[model samples]
Target: MEKVINETDDKIKQYNVCVSYFDTLQECSFSCCFPVNVKPPVIVSADILKFPRTEYICGENFALDGIEAKVCFSDNEFLLYNYGENEGLFSSDVTTLNKTGNNEVEIKIRNKYNNDGFKYILTVIVKENRLVSIDIGKNNEGDVYFRLGKQYTDKVFFDHFSVTKHFEYNKGMTHDIKNNVVFNFEKLQYLGNGSFTGVLYARYTENEKTYYGEYVCDASGNNRIILLTPLPVSLTTEKAESVNISNLAQKLKSANITYKVRYQDNTELTFTGDVFNNNTYSCNGVTYTINCNKNSIWLDWKADKMDCKETSLEAGKLYIEDFWYYGEEDLIKSVDFKNEKTLIFESENIIPEDLSSYFSATVEYITGCKITINGNQLNKSIDKENKLITVSYNGLKFQHSFSYSYSSNGD
Candidate 1:
């Protein structure tokens, strides 16, 4: 009897055979049954002879080297999966170690016949390479700034620079590449005297490889201590009185008003300039208000005067030359005036102190004419409501009704 068995698919099989003799007369036959068992191939042992180095620097390129893998089958047949170098049977999740600290790389190998895979975990210790140094400096504005040292500037390309310590001041530090090629800390206004110590971090590229580095920056000395305070004494000048209106701009350029600023070192620095806005001078982020005395230049000009025609002064026959107030003239123009039917003027509730200034007006007209409020004199009708101010001159009458309120505030 002959039979064929497939070793890969069939594990076991059974067969029966019979033999016959004396074919003509009395036929006798003997039968026997037998079974066959087939052993399937299985992986008995698999191992790696050598692995790549488990340590590397950050951003350093590396590949699998001197790695060899072999597998032993159940039939005692040994197959070389990888020898000397990678034979396309070995693969890894990481080609180069780019992350710092412990980076887990999974190396895998699979048997082609059974589709079984094996994994090896490799922890690569990637250390950071410190290649640059930082130092403290100042800009043209005398503001504290930081930059990479001159010795390393040409060797490395700056990617990002930041302050790692002093989180309160770190938020104010900014990196500007165009005009200011440094980390500017001028916006941190509250930094006081003494040694300012902080960690400076940088990420740069060198020779087509990325690197990270840190530096401890300590800034000291008188120039590093930024202290500014506006002195209590006011600054004034009488130059505005003699200068004409057209030459005021030229006069102000030459006018030098000196002021004192106290620093942390108990030393006062005198700064002289005429750049005053509304009797105020601002320098180094500090604003100082110049107190204008009787002889001061700002008090000589009647800049606070407003024209009566610009306001809601709708009176007939009575001529209003000018109107003056101590505060902003724009506040007077903000009042809503309605000319419908009655020529009424409405205003917000003015405080007690501002009422006297708001009511100041200069009037001119014919003889025997006076300004009255609610049929009484302007000074005596202070407590009356629906106040009406009227001026009558030679039978020509001028009247205006005001609709407004005020808060006395216990006055």
Candidate 2:
């Protein structure tokens, strides 16, 4: 009897089998029962004899034809060879060369008889012989842009170019064979993030000496790329503290009290009693007003304003929010001329002092400018590195700082 089985690394599982033999004289069939073993395919040995050359230049074909591998597999045949999370991410395995940055391709072999397979991973890093210059600027549509120069600096030694793009929303596309000086893209993104990246295949030639190659580049906020219009910051209550309306009445100065309330529905209501930001209100967007009227209080609704002597208000969704004019508070972490949302800048010193438990503001420096908190001077030291001026007074901590840079032309 002949035994049939595939050698693999899986736990040995018995596969029942039947074998038959024909008798010439009697013309009858005789059968014998046996067991075969089945498991996952095993990679006995493998050597990548030839792989595509590393650091390929732009505008030049990145040949994958040289990817020759000597793989000893327990499988019936090699089934798949592709690159990236989805195939044809930057360039095709069967058709083109490497266009993106460092990338890898996977080779899979499967045996149909025993249903076993082996996988091999190979890497390729490509580069071009061009200097990369990057900066933050604007695009044609007045949006903030990240500029990546692909042979734009060395335009005199050049010809047409090629580019490749991989986006966060989907697998990227290759924009090869373009006769332009600068390859323009909306944005540049890092891997696994929701953004876009462009690869340039630039060709430079002059005096019978031409340099041909490609390189991948990312914008430098040190891997932090900023966009013109990003999504809004969502409101969260995990860190919120509820507030009481009666506490707001303490800030009033009149016997017949009045208050301007910003309720939870994002609507405003005026009552003659008291109003303050609820401790549980969001810490970033609520506004509070306390007014003592002689006999009537000015009340603001969703759209209209009115005068009221005494009115009862059932508060709903009441919260406190403190924010500058620009945008969210957390995003404006590092206070500078570039990160301001509300306070105005340019030759003016403004103190963002609040009567509440906490206060924030920007401290502009002009070499000899003095800073004071609660009628007292602050420390003489300035953190030039962070461009921030620090101040704390009467149990209140404040970070007030902004550093300025001269215009490119020293304006």
Candidate 3:
């Protein structure tokens, strides 16, 4: 057995030669005991890999922030010749699977002395990087619908089944807008003087329940500039209205103020005609009742007529109201007042007066907020039930003024 090497040592060819008796070239056979390469290169993590054939790679998904695999080879003399993600990529000794799931890595090793080489398959599982942001794409109408859009930077992230968390529209069920999103009831209510300055109520699915936030929208050429609350909120949607404008109406002296909606062309539509009777108001030639979901602005219009026990049987009427909501998202529709005896409550306002001896008030909020009453806490009691707070010896029933702000993360 004889073995010879070429200059490059990359070619393996066999030739047969014999000296014929007639001085002509003829075929002859030769034998040799040449060493045959028997085994492939061994890798410590190779057993964890899938296919060992031409399709030598398989992968799974990971969501953890930091995870890495350590690969050790059988021999140190073998060269870590070339390793990369693709054909034209540069080779590096250390391969990284750090991105959100779009992954491929190649680890190629070869014998330093011969033409024998091996390609190792590396299955990288990087977590999918998910993105959540407020999106205001146009609706079926030319007007834009505010919605929350989830974007995936890499397609491999989806292929690896990295999307585990399912999304819900709003935990509070404020709207029917799909994809865990919220939108304005009006088309272009965000547009103001020179820019847009209005609040938007938005919901997304990172947590199980509905959430609320207020975003101030500004128009920039063709795009909207908005700021969302970074913290989380759990303000419960109150079944009964969370606002009591019966006392707030005292500030307005129960005035009959007209509510009007102005359009882009300076055209105005009136919502309230006669403040005493709230049947339905006409706007833009369309008639509507007081509703938060519709074009008619919802208000803190609260009026209650209680039977007062004075020297004579007289009616104690508290007729106080105003139109405080510009759009659906700007109103406070509900709140959770299960606990806290001193739970400060405020309403998103606009009210009408009813001289009847019955108590009825409704408050709805679109944005997330907390209500604070100034000094009028409920202290007056009727038998065991409280009616109003008594001020002086005269027993005057007057609720103090109130203000409101956004809710904190856990409040």
Candidate 4:
């Protein structure tokens, strides 16, 4: 009987039998039983690698994700490091890799039945670290952001070259490249909140052959690129403030209100306001005033303003143009002239004295003369005399010693 069972088992194995049923075969014709064949599990090919091998720093985050295979890494074999589950994907944050020599990233995977499928071996080529220029936040937590701002200073860099690269990292994660240059400025403590509102300035000195960069800020709480034209060029804010022209209601049309533009390098553009649609705007190719139902924000002229002969600007585009002005016929209580040709006008805001608010008029004759306002203290003597004017500011007394000249010169 034992010999018969052995013969049956052999026959079953040879025929690739699916089941063993001894009752189906007679003792004389009995054969062996065999199990069905099982196939080997499938293995997925996964890898780990660095992006740009040559960079300035090493401690910076090295991020990893979107891995479709089970993976693990270790400095030693006794302690096994598992990264993904059976038939799962994995990733990693910034971690130290082998600085020199060959570093390997090992991986193992299992199939549906949890059977070992295959193990993969990967190599990471770690290169020596180098020092390059960085202009954004520190690389501690690995995440950072930056924005354009207005800042004028001499400390940030060389006299001619400036840095403008903004970067952020966290757990070694990288951006989608499109938004790489843009970063949030609030989180970086080294780059103060105020600096984000300043411009990213750079200067490259030909003599020194060095590049320097800094952030510049405007007085009106905005950070803009120092020389680079802002992206999207212009932005229109909903009018939230009322523009009251009733004060100059009398001098509306007959005498053009002087328009003054303050530009880079202390350059100024002066023109007169032209009234249209109950709003007054300067005539220079760069500025205009718009009156909306609710609010009004300054809209800059587009880049094509010089080529296009239209005073009307696009509805919601951003451009840098003139906004402020001074007129030739506007009443002046005081006027003073300096060697550089300074002429001060007299105007006061409607604020109480205790409020620490003082107003003075500035007369700008585009590329001509800029009058730096000293003070606007009520000149009772000038008001009484109707011609003589006197003003005081910070212990400096200035009197009006000039007359109003309105020669349009065919203007």
Of candidates 3 and 2, the better by lDDT = 2
The residue-by-residue lDDT of candidate 3 on 242-315, one tens digit each, is 33433222212223334444332344443333432354432222233333322222332211211111133211
Which pairs in model 1 have colliding backbones?
Answer: none
lDDT of 2 at 153: 41
Q: Could you give the candidate ranking by lDDT, starting with the highest?
A: 1, 2, 4, 3
Best candidate according to lDDT: 1
Q: Which scores higher on lDDT, 1 or 3?
A: 1
Per-model CA lDDT versus the true structure: 0.40, 0.35, 0.30, 0.32
Off by over 4 Å in 1: 1-39, 47-50, 56-67, 83-411
lDDT of 1: 0.40
Q: How well does candidate 2 score on lDDT at residue 44?
A: 54
Better of 2 and 4 by TM-score: 4
- Candidate 4 overall Cα lDDT vs. reference? 0.32
Model 2 misplaced regions, further than 4 Å: 2-41, 58-63, 74-117, 129-411
Best by TM-score: 1
Model 1 lDDT tens row, 15-134: 443333444455655555465555446666777777677777666665666667777777787677753443566678877677889988887775544555567777778776543332
- Mind giving the per-residue lDDT tens digits that candidate 2 earns over 1-411? 455555544466887788889998998989998787676655555555655455444444544454544545556433323232223212333234336566565554333234344455666654543432222222122112222211124232122222333222212323332343343333445432222343334443334444444433334323232221121122212111232223222323332433344332243434433233431212122222323233222222221111111133212222222222112222122222122233222322323343121223333222112232332332222344554444432223334444433333432
Estimate, for each residue in 1-411, the C-alpha lDDT of model 4 and write its tens digit.
222223212122323453333554564444565545433223343333322232323344333332343222221112122333321533232366635545555444333333433455545555444322234221122111222222323332222223333233222322221111222122122333122222342333333344343443434534332222111233311111233332332233223444344432234544444443355443322334442221222333432121112244322323222223322222223344322222223332221232112325344432234456534332312332333233433233433332222224411
Q: How does each model score on TM-score?
A: 0.28, 0.20, 0.25, 0.22
Report the Cα lDDT for residue 126, model 2.
49
Better of 1 and 4 by TM-score: 1
